[model samples]
Target: MQKIPYTTINGGSVPMMILSVFSMITFTSVYGFDSVWTEWWWTYDGFSGPAWWGTKWPICTMGRYQSPIDILPDKLLFDPNLTGVVFSSEKKINGNLTNTGNDITLFVDDVIVPLINATSGPLQYVYHLHHIKLHFGHDEASGSEHTVNGQAFPAEIQLYMFNADLYANYTQAMSSPNGLVAVSIFLEVGKIGNEAYTMISNALTHIPTKGQQHRVHGLPLSVLLPQTKEYITYEGSLTQPQCQETVTWVIFNKPIYITEQQLTQLRNVNKEGGSHLLIFGNIRPSQPMYNRLVRTNINFRPKTKVCSMVKEVFYEVNTVQTRSGR
Candidate 1:
């Protein structure tokens, strides 16, 4: 049976005490969110026909603002009104790292620990931290969900939040139009590794099989984000099934670095039930922009000053060489 929240007035069951302790100490699947595993294009079942999804899950084919769209640098509009996003979480938040069938998720225990809160970007309401998930591939070439100028990064990370002002729970928020916010950061392979991600990557060896969860403590949410706050904002749906169009996407312009060893650790997680099938490469193909305006917080000038100056010097030298030849 699903565990219920504890109350001080009614008490005394052994199971209740255990449940309360576990809930306060860790984050379990409170929402019970599920995605279709068999219907994906990359899966062994391999039934990727959009027609089938239209029949089974209409939202997959019908959503107007679908996620994982390529962000064309030339196409983005500069929104002077867009403000910088504010993100604050506890310095030492404890969590349980779970190898969910689809991806690896770090579930924060917010009841005992302070939950992360974000506000004031392109958002009208305050958003409370929900969870974080990782998406990666076999190599450093192509793993990210959203691409910039059709270029894919090695991996990507998504930090999710639910609108606290509008809804009391996650299910209700998923049903609303503006109920979720996702902060996406791209990951690149580098010489040095990220210490924040080491907490999760180190635990992947223990939870190789699906449905396996391990406890992790004192994880700082601040270290997981990119150093820069500059980002591109757009309206998009969840990349997974049920394809809810409730997310306001804030994809960071800057990417964080992870080492080759760290990437290998992420690629080692297996499919559920001891199948031993590594859950590597879970990026959904980019969706069409379809007349939607991708907005950025800052204005982008097309050319660099240094490049323009170099071009002028090169032109002058070329003319001199040509005149001498004549």
Candidate 2:
């Protein structure tokens, strides 16, 4: 039998040094180099294999009792007490368009909604509108929400609001449903085009791909709201990741329209530093029915009071202390 010679380095075994170096390289490749760990390992199920983890943790498993759900008009019941009053200060705002290859940014304003009111129940919660974001796609049919007749709209705008008192940080609110409310608006391609697009588009030249800071003046949210005020309401969650089921969705029946050229400019926006910001479709797919009810509301008229018959589920998470002691 032949014997292999042992090597030493700095009063230690050389083999151990080689092994340590190999371990470090493996660790760096798996974690330090990229975000693969966050995408796979840090999820609900620990990383094992594609099949094992995928089965254990499907898409909706991470959701709480409530989540972001799509509401169909026919299924909703009208309610006068649960009405939401729409108000805007007519203040112009601006932000940088950080188009980082995937999502495009437009009018990321610092909005503050000091007040919100809801009906009494588990869903009775007040929140604030923190900021608003706009996303446009290549074609009119590539929006987030599709019509019941299976027709896609032109663009989608997400008004991201949060419980200003509950979670001081946006990231915390995103991970859990209790602190966020996203009002989504679908835009259609019309012959007249949308006037709201003009307010942001005329300033597009000032905002470059890498993110040029642009200002908007007198761009009130009322311009984007549906005139009819007839909306489909449901108890859902945020559409983004860590999909918490804590949002009260109010989807308007009518849609706003924008021209093809305005849509092109919005799609061309890039994130800061010349990143390849590809503003593809940013809307999440419609979620399950989940034994939830959809409600609707019309103008205030002399009619009998009708209550929403939606099924409600109790979430046992400890309530956080708020300034209002809610």
Output the number of the lDDT-best candidate.
1
C-alpha lDDT values of all predictions:
0.71, 0.52
lDDT of 2 at 303: 44
For 26-113, candidate 2 gives per-residue lDDT tens digits of: 8868677435433434321124332233243354453434333444434444565655545443544344434333344543445434
Off by over 4 Å in 1: 1-45, 48-52, 112-114, 302-326
lDDT of 1: 0.71
Residue-wise C-alpha lDDT for candidate 1, range 214-287, written one tens digit per residue = 98877777887777667788899888766788999998867777898889888878877767787777777777
lDDT of 2 at 57: 37
